[model samples]
Target chain A: MDASLLTIQPASPEPIYRQIVEQLRRLIAGGQLGAGDLLPSVRDVAAFHAINPMTVSRAYGMAESEGLLERLRGKGMAVAATVRPTQTQTQRLALLEPQLQALVRHARELELPADAVLRRLGRLLED
Target chain B: MNAMLKDAADRPGPPLAARDLGHGYEGATVLRGIDLDIAAGSVLGLIGRNGAGKSTLLRALLGLLEPTTGETRVFGKPALAMDDGIRQRIAYVPQQPEALAWLTVAQMFDYLGRFYPRWNHAFARDTLARWQLPANKLFGKLSPGERQRVELVRALASEPELLVLDEPAAALDPVARRELLREIALRACEAGITVVFSTHIVSDLERVASDIAFLHQGRLLLHCPVDDTKERYARLWLPARLGPHAPASTLGRRSHADGSVSVVIERDAHGRWPDEAAQPGVRLDVLGLEDLFVEIAE
Candidate 1:
């Protein structure tokens, strides 16, 4: 996998390692990363992102525990040979739950009507 | 087996420790009541603004300067009286690395290598080649960044169990800095070398430091794991109309001309953000290391 594909927001509320885990999950679910694919070494990801290697290791470990990744003998980590099922449509859509909540919260904060906010979201999705 | 690694497992306490460390120069205190501990396999990033006593604290920890009050220890022995056996396992790169002007890089390395029984010449040679440092160049003729790299190579070649770096990357370009961070991470993760490095560059600290220490005005303000810091500290933006009602968690506050106020706050022990911050008209935001430094140290 291209380590560059994974980036973390330092200022985000979520911890850095958790961000890595979530991004990797999305990639795996989307088939961007396939079974037996070599995941970037902890050092590569850490050096590229300027994050602690231990943080990268923790993310990889979490993914391993969840069956998304597996460690190979003397070869570091790789995508699991047998992947779990791809996320269902609802499950995939659920990935946007936090973002949708933010949109609603901001719309409320701005005192925009539901119809207007939905119109804006509709236009954005069309784009 | 290397002497440094032979009995490391038998050691009892933290690799490095300082108790209520204080230092004064010409009646002015540069560090006060600073207590810090570095474990065997962790990295601690020491961060403070200029004149915030970062260099002083590092020097005190290395026993290069005797603190006016308190004490420091390496390998369970008082730093000031550390014997050669303990000293051999520790390496320090000072903020300004001084080298003799006449010697070339190879000469300098050769001279220094004579002092350490475990110095790895091949590793030093390979690192110098990788870093693109010219071995035949006069030590003093090299640029500041080159000199810093040379100092780091020297420090790493000895394979020290505990490494102390003071602003080691301040002179390097971004690429060099990244390479240095990678090497530090590799050593700490693979060899269990303990590292304590001080840097003004907050992003560098975010990269490889397991824990971070914030020093302000000669005091050690905060020292904790980096992730816990994110969990415990936050920033809240409130509409100006609400007026400035100071909450118990407020650490610092700033008001903008645009009718909003931003306040730094600490989360309660139960991991709860400030009560008011969760209410309408207030937005709670997480802070990165740079912002945290500004909030707590400014």
Candidate 2:
């Protein structure tokens, strides 16, 4: 992916490292960054965004710990070749925590029952 | 100091260090009792209000000015007794560069390049072209922003092991500021250059600084890694009823008309808030870098 695809908000209360990690995780989950896609080097990202390289390194380190990324010898970082096989199904689902939270909140505010919301979700998934 | 910590003799010294460094002029102390050791290859951002002695501190650190008391060590030698060999390894750009103003930008660079052993002529030429600066124009004739950029180019062209700037972005437009920040990040990441720059712009510091030194009234109030800022200090609020129990001393404190008290507090070595935070009606807030500076500097 191009460095321009990674957006950074310097004014946000959230730490920059967390911002990068969240964006990369979402992109990976959405298949925008497919398996084996080579990630940009830390120096390039730092230079492009004018941010500390250590901050970028820290985010990459967290992703590696989460099994979402792997480092290749002499090739820098890349998306893990396979889905994070070690993470349990429930753990993988946890990546959608924000969307699930919004869905639940809106369903509750709309006075929709949990069963109805699940059925709607099922229908959407089938479609 | 840890058992694993190397002996002073065995360890390589940081590029910059000060011990009990103090300075004053005309019977007014601008800075005092500063002890700082900048980690090698780390970018240190100095911040303070106007006339808070940031310039004075940097001058003393760079051996350009003698402090009233204490001493500084640059490259393992006394700051005041620096030799040309050591001086050539460091580059400093002042808030306003007045030297060689009559010379054309090209001529000025030519002279400086001769003196700086490791000057990068191609980098200087390329940046001037990219920024559209007229190298043929007299240095004094350029706009303040343009002059500042020329000074920046001069500094970076030296490829100094240590780079220091006083408010390098003060005169630049947003685009120029971002470009300067990008250049700093690129150098630090690729060349492992140690950099110290004083700036009031917090966003710029957030982008490129690995460490921050908040100078207040000539004293270093805070010196820590950028990432540690949010977790290190907090603002504690106490409603009027609970205000009486608030800590007597804090980094900064204020009492509202309604008797509510707001005080800036810090986590202890163990990362635990003070006991009072657990009291009923007390609220703790993690402060952003700007907010933390405001809370203390105000």
DockQ score of each predicted structure, in the order shown: 0.42, 0.30
CA lDDT, every model vs. true structure? 0.83, 0.85
For model 1, the superposed segments whose C-alpha errors exceed 4 Å read A2-5, A8-14, A47-50, A71-76, A81-85, A104-127, B1-5, B99-102, B130-134, B137-144, B257-259
lDDT of 2 by residue, B1-298 (tens): 2321232235356789999999999999999999999987799989888988899999999889989999999877899998887788789999888878899999999999999977899999999988889999999999877888898899999988789999998877788789989988888877777899999998888778999999999889889988777767888888898898997655789888999998988888998988987775577776778888888888
TM-score of chain B of 1: 0.92
Whole-model lDDT for model 2 versus the true structure? Answer: 0.85
lDDT of 1 by residue, A15-124 (tens): 78888989888888888988898988887787677677888988999999988899999989999998744867886786788788887667655657899888888999
Worst 10 residues of 1 chain B by lDDT: B242-251
**Best candidate, DockQ-wise?**
1
lDDT by residue (B174-233, candidate 1, tens digit) is 887887888888887667789999998877787688999988889988889888778788
Candidate 1 DockQ, CA atoms = 0.42
